[model samples]
Target: MRINVLQHTPNEGPGSIQRWSQEHGHEMYIYHPYQFGNLPTSDQTDMLVILGGPMSPNDDLDWIEQERVLIRQLLADHKPIFGACYGAQQIAKTLGYAIKKAPHKEVGWAPVYLKSDIIPGIPEKLTALHWHEEMFEVPDQADLLFSSDLVKNQGFIMNGNVIGLQFHFEPEADNVREIAINDNQYPLEHNDLHQTGKEIIDHGVPTENKQVMYQLLDFMVKNS
Candidate 1:
């Protein structure tokens, strides 16, 4: 399988998702729209993955709009897509769902409760990394997958092909630390979002939660 990853920032790269792809011997291509030009055609992609970032979908960036159009087209064609954090918000906004600021920012390792009807392969409770101030309304055409206290629409699945996750299912301990340290400004500026590097790392990776990441990738590969 050839997966095309839409990376929005340098700090938040593919992380575990990239590892999964390599472990399975799948080719991975990256489209950094912030640095590159327009996105490539969907025909060149077997699966589309939109990674997390600090930028919001509502930002005034020209590439953001272009990427949204590309994602909408991919969804229209029934191509498989996996989005994380801001990537998930972009997926919602492109599908005509609302994205806005949440009541509080969720910026640490938090437990997410999987829906009873959740894809059947995921565990009930898993601690996942989160770092977003905005959340999205569940698209009318999608199924809610999981939820956290701070964000009700933590994840959703559309047409059995597009999966949007508000939390960092791809996070490894190092990735979490790097993200926290690199993007410390936002957390430091907002009282509701402050967390030390030790606190974030101490939350650690749950074995069951890490398995969920593989389950998600397996599902996408089989479905695709």
Candidate 2:
């Protein structure tokens, strides 16, 4: 299978997802518009994985809106999509949901409670990597999958083929360190909802979360 990833920045590239592709013997391609200077359509991509970025879907950027258009086209085609963080907000917006700044910044390791059983192997609570201050409401009729105390819509699935998560399900240790050093939102202030960079990195990133991520990705590939 051919999986294409839409990445917005250099540092926050697909981490374990890249490794998962290799292990599953699937070809993976990435689109970094700042580097490539062009976006790709979903004609050749069997599955689409949209990664998180610093940009909000409401930003005055062409690519942001273009990605949403691409998302709409993919939805019309009934293609499988996985949106994480900022990408998740985009998915919600495409379905006419409102995306707004979260009540507080969630910028470290935290727990997201699973609220639905549309997909198995996902736990009731998973510690995930988070780095965003924006959140989205659940789109109309979409299956709200996960939630946290800070937000009511942490994730949602539409048509069983498109999945969106407000947190990173597959967090690589190196990627965590890179974001901590570069994102400047890290070294979190004293708050119960946030964690320090060391606190997030010291545990070495839970292998179980990555396992759940792989299971969800495999399920999408099979069901798509």
Candidate 3:
């Protein structure tokens, strides 16, 4: 399988997802739109993985619009797409859903609750890294998959091929540290909602959440 990852920034790379791709002997390609100024042709991609970013989906950036077009094309072709955080927001916006500010920003490590056992190949609950000030509405055609206390719509799946997660399932220990130090711009008041740098590292890799990514990849590979 060839996995094409659309990276928005240097810090928010593929992280654990990269490891999963390599372990499965799948080719991993990264596109840094911020640095490269363009996206790959849809012909070159099989499964698309859109990573997180600090920017909001509403930002009137040229690359954002271009990526939106690419997302629409991927959906039209029935290509499997997995989007996280800002990428999820972009997916929501492109799918005709709305993205707006949440009541409170979700930062640090948080436990995401399973709304249903419909997650056939993954576990029920998992702790996922989160760093976002904006939230998105689930598309009418999609099913709500997971939710956290801070955010009701943590994830949604469309046509079982397109998955959007608001939390960071691909986060590494270093990624958590970087987000903790730099995400101070988004104020989070609830202490329980926050996690110390050491805490996030101590928790280590989210094995269950990582399995979800693997399951998603498996589904994509079989279906695609």
Question: Which candidate comes out best when scored by TM-score?
Answer: 1
Predicted candidate 1: what Cα RMSD to the true structure? 1.6
Q: Whose lDDT is higher: candidate 1's or candidate 3's?
A: 1
In candidate 3, position 130 carries an lDDT of 78
Estimated TM-score for each candidate: 0.93, 0.93, 0.90
Worst 10 residues of 3 by lDDT: 183-192
Q: List the global CA lDDT of all models.
A: 0.83, 0.82, 0.81
Worst 10 residues of 1 by lDDT: 185-194
lDDT, candidate 1, 37-94, per-residue tens: 7587878878899998878998999999988888877877778899999999999999
Better of 1 and 3 by TM-score: 1
Alpha-carbon lDDT of model 2: 0.82
> Per-residue CA lDDT of candidate 2, range 1-224, in tens?
88889998877888888889999999998998646656668698788888998888888877777888888888888888999998888889888888998887787777889899989878898888877888988888788999887777788887888889998976688888787777654446634465776776675788787798888787777777
Which residue runs does candidate 1 get wrong by more than 4 Å?
116-118, 191-194
Q: What does the lDDT come to for candidate 3?
A: 0.81
Q: What lDDT is reached at residue 197 by model 3?
A: 51
| Clashing residue pairs, backbone N/CA/C < 3 A, model 2 | none
